[model samples]
Target: MPFVADALTATYKGIPPSFQWPVKFCFYNSLIAFVLGAATGNVSQVDRVWTFLPTIYAAYYALLPLWPSKSPLPLYPFVPETAHPDVIRNYSPRALLMFGLIFVWMCRLTFNTWRRGLFNLKDEDYRWEILRGKMPPWLFQMFNLVFIAFMQNVILFVIAVPVQIAAMQQPTGLGTSDCVLAVLALLDVAMEFVADNQQYAFQTFKHTGKKDEWPGAHIAWTKTDLKRGFITRGLWAWSRHPNFFCEQTFWVLINFFPLVAPEYPGYAPPLPLGAGTSLESLFPIIPGLVICSLFFSSTKFTESITAAKYPEYKSYQQRVSMFVPFLTPVWGLYLTLLGKKAEVDMVVYGQDVALDEKKKA
Candidate 1:
């Protein structure tokens, strides 16, 4: 077992203990995911494991010190008696808090994916099929290898890199900022869960004519709601893709955990760098920034598809902010001042428009 484990992880020994196995994991998953995708003609291989990988990396950093000398993968490592309880009575409490919060995030997303039947090995995101039609066959395969398999895994790795910040600063125990961030991260997750369920409910109602299952069915969905061809009520009224907003924000909050915690010592979001400082100095916030970049590009691609499918979607774009809720009305008002208030309102508030029309009739 030791021999085989060493052989598997041999290539990564020179890398830091914290990042050693993760680089391997990322490579292995990317290779296998790309191969399986090419062979199976399903490039959504990475999507199935998306919820698990980041959490696994979180655990790697949080529990890094406990990693036994003999283990193959660095997960659930053996703890020695000499180790401080505070660092990992189970794990780096700061990183572990990030882990716990991320675990909850994993559960919510996994459940959502499962219910959507996306967990099926044969099923792929509908968007991929649309993309395939647009690109040449050879070029699409390159995209599958580059973006779908490799880069997505890299993003997963980098996004969880902030936990490495927590891991490195282990002696720093959880403080008020940790608790505050935890609450905010949970709130972010809660809102995302709501957005997922709302979309789920609307999608269910759209297909089955059945109201969504409880708690999630916050809005009493109607035929008019269905007629809009996309939701514009509840959180959707405020942000075009509230779920995407939360998904991106969750990581940004995760990045902040290590930054502001005074106990972590010398950490800040953007540290003061000497002219000699390497670009590595900025790695902490890259997670949040890159995830935001991914989401921004994804939203644009997705909305292009959506706008083509549903004409009213353009007006929704004009009226609602993309990822931030508070800016929604401001954007709407800006559009209104540009003389699009009525058209944008008619589409975005089609339900209300219907009610007033019926009343007048």
Candidate 2:
């Protein structure tokens, strides 16, 4: 692992400045995980599939030498030793609710990623291709292995620890709030899945067209004479990037579940005696909220990049909401604050709004 770490460092040194921050963030998170493992003398290879480091670290901490040496209760149905007796004894129902929500989130996201050919060894994301153009193969591979592959996965997993902690420490009982959260999570996953599928189908259709044939069968390709590659139908029509909106919504909903217990009506059933108070009572909601905020900021950055890429994007932005569909009135405030000028029948894809150049010319 030391040799692997050293190799990763060297590879990171060669990357362009723009990609370095996210890559370094991953490395830094992994380093912290390693240090924590070393300090607890529990250093051992954990399966890469369960890469969320916070839950792993929490479980590790729960089973540390300082605590009564026994397995923690399972946080998810699949994860072993996730919830120990000590944890369960102090469990908060609200936390467990969040845990369940996150489990669903992880499964959906992991499944989507797998289906998108992301799990295939032969293919990688296009963003990686862009990075490769600016760096050596070996160095890029090492950087990807450590930062993109290992560390990023670990950080996401670890950041989700609050769900596990909430489950372990919170009491358990069904409630209207839980039902509401479940519904929201389901909707979030569904929207993201649909958006991803649509985008995938559009790209595939574009690639398989005959040499002389016009691009069709996808909304983004409708104006075939125009060479705009932007997606603009289905959920994309509602929000230029619906998948991003759904992804952010999913995480926020997961984080919000713990807070719901306190807000739930008194008619909601209480947990068994000794199960403790609400999950938020045990662990503050602020950290998870802050993490959700960061995720939203990241989504904004992605949207900005997308807008810059597609000439038609600004016009689409004027007509559509960014994060919320059918919430045009709310987004109007944002446009006003930015002092954006609106133009009717603005063509987005073919040429710069300022220029009337034709494709051939």
Candidate 3:
């Protein structure tokens, strides 16, 4: 892990030393959030910051090049813009695009979370509350400090580092790959918007008893008790967590923007302005892997509760893909014919078969 961390650090050869301020801010904020969460018994302080950091980081990069003093930010020791023939005289276009995308995402996410009253300090994420009941107080506090507060913030910062990478590059011109990235990012954002709206409409109708105004494919599902449980139509039908899929894919595409330039090899990390690609370019993908792991664990935790609450959720699990869209049938067929473990759910449950039993523990 130490070597892995070092290798990951090596990937950002052209990042300015002044970028440390944002990292320090993240650490201090995370520490404060950890202490406050432990004191107040609400772990959502970290969640509140999640939507905002990418925009902050993107804006920081977009503005840093315009800073009036070079004395404040030490240039990248490995590379200088002078060595590149295509170096632009102004702010990076890539960073500006990222800033715009991140700012929009931040606004949408913040509004949705706030609309649910999650912005209130008294309100905690239901997932944390559920997990807390299952662990000793001391153990759960440690988990909150380590995983919830510290590690999650680190992952958030790491994933946004690609914006910095893109900013460091000298803009020659936009290429076909840049346009492709833009399209994919916009599509992912659209998918996430649709998924969130569908879920929100379902929940609002479920609570308000306003079935007449149910939007999208939700109208078909509301006639049954299952509508009170989970979404089964529209984007949800394509994947159990279409929003999660899109969120992960969006960042992966952002990371790819730095890689797509002809100057950087497909898998190589960006180098000094005049340098060639090395094997280290492979390291930038680690952030995407971190995000995928976070979603995998998150889905597992969320589904544990869902599977217990809704009996039909297991059936839904067997029918629909977990992350990737439209692959469940292929997985189901393989498990049935070859693996001889067709009865296995996407995730195996423990002996605590009842939701009440798990809650009590």
Candidate 4:
């Protein structure tokens, strides 16, 4: 294991310093997480770095323009005179945009997690506890090392790779596609904000039993209030995990910046950069793909637990969409474009759940 870790470390160091430092930062953080998790049985060590690391990466990229080229710092190594003689070293507009957006996101996520008591480590994610219960101790330990500490940290860094890659290339200026990508990122953020607020409101209402007393989204689940179960309101009415969907979409949009950049050699979404001809260039897409896959698997596990807890979840799943909210509207449009009549399944519930007519009707 030490040999493998050494080999990985050496490989990381071989890259330019811009990539080298962030990769090493992620590696050390994950290693610390593994040690903490193994010793203390708290697998959420990775969670602590989740929101902050991306901001660091984004800030690294955003501040590239400020670093003097002739300086002895590691930032100078990113613009190897021989390799990137023509590369612009100015601060990237796209990167500045990305940095600002990520800062906002990091604050929101950190606040949300902190509010749930994650900052002091007083509370670990429920998913970790549930997995610990299901797996034997030894197996769970292995899972902790491989998945929680290693894989998750790696994935988190990968999702932020675009910011690093963009800074490395240092595209001349923001274009149409860059603006579009920025807007898309913010729109996803907005969606996630709405979804999270809805879920938070529902949970508060449920736990406090102050549905009518509270000044938020009304939770008039009289029939299921006695049962005490999942929420089916606001963004939840359209999709089971709207927040997860938005989260995935935002990262995927991050990957698009490279595609739209004027300096990118490739024509596709996952434009490779190192040497342009090697398979390593394709590595940029790994973060987005991995995140999408992770969310899919995560949703399945979360839904199972939720289903066992709530009797009506199955019916909700049968009626409303899962990842895509109000998929019927999109599907209906697709069918209409093909000159075929399609009836959207806009009805989610008969009486117990009431959906806003603006959703489809």
Number of the predicted model whose TM-score against the real structure is largest: 1
Ranking by TM-score: 1, 4, 3, 2
Window of ten residues with lowest summed lDDT in model 3:
75-84
- The per-residue C-alpha lDDT of model 4 at residue 38 equals 88
Clashing pairs in 3: 268-281, 269-281
For residues 1-361, what per-residue lDDT tens digits would candidate 3 score against the true structure?
3673365357435443534445555666677889899888889888887888777767776665544332244322122343232222456677677777778778778877877777777888899989999999999999998999999888887787777666667455667877788888887887787788787777766777565333343443334433436676567766889889989888888888877766465323342222444634555676788888999999999999999998768867776788898696676686678663334432222222234345758
Q: Write the per-residue lDDT of candidate 1 for residues 1-361, one digit (tens) a residue.
A: 4664576556543444445557767877898899999999999999999999999889877776667644455444443344344434445678889999999999999999999998898899989999999999999999999999999999998899888778767644689889999999999999999899889988988998987664555676766778887888778888989999999989999989888877545542222122234655666667899999999998899999999999888888888898899998799779878998877787777756468559769
In angstroms, give how far residue 100 of model 3 lies from its true place.
1.6
Total clashes for model 2: 23
Q: Could you report the Cα RMSD, in angstroms, for every candidate shown? A: 4.4, 12.0, 9.0, 5.7
Worst 10 residues of 4 by lDDT: 341-350
Number of the top lDDT candidate = 1
User: For every model shown, what is its TM-score relative to the native structure?
Assistant: 0.87, 0.56, 0.77, 0.80
Residue range 1-361, candidate 2, lDDT tens digits: 6785577557744542222323444455556545543354232212233324444333332333233323243222121233245442454556545555555666766665665556543443454455567788667656655655565555464455445434543345657866898898887877786787777666655566422222222343444323556655557656766777787677667655655655433222222122445653533454455555655665666567667887666777776777678776556566666765334224432234223334326
Which ten-residue region of model 2 has the weakest summed lDDT? 74-83
Off by over 4 Å in 4: 1-9, 65-89, 211-228, 266-278, 328-361
Local accuracy by lDDT, each model:
0.80, 0.52, 0.69, 0.69
Q: After superposition, how far is residue 220 of candidate 3 from its true place, in Å?
A: 3.8
Model 4 scores a C-alpha lDDT of 0.69
lDDT of candidate 2? 0.52
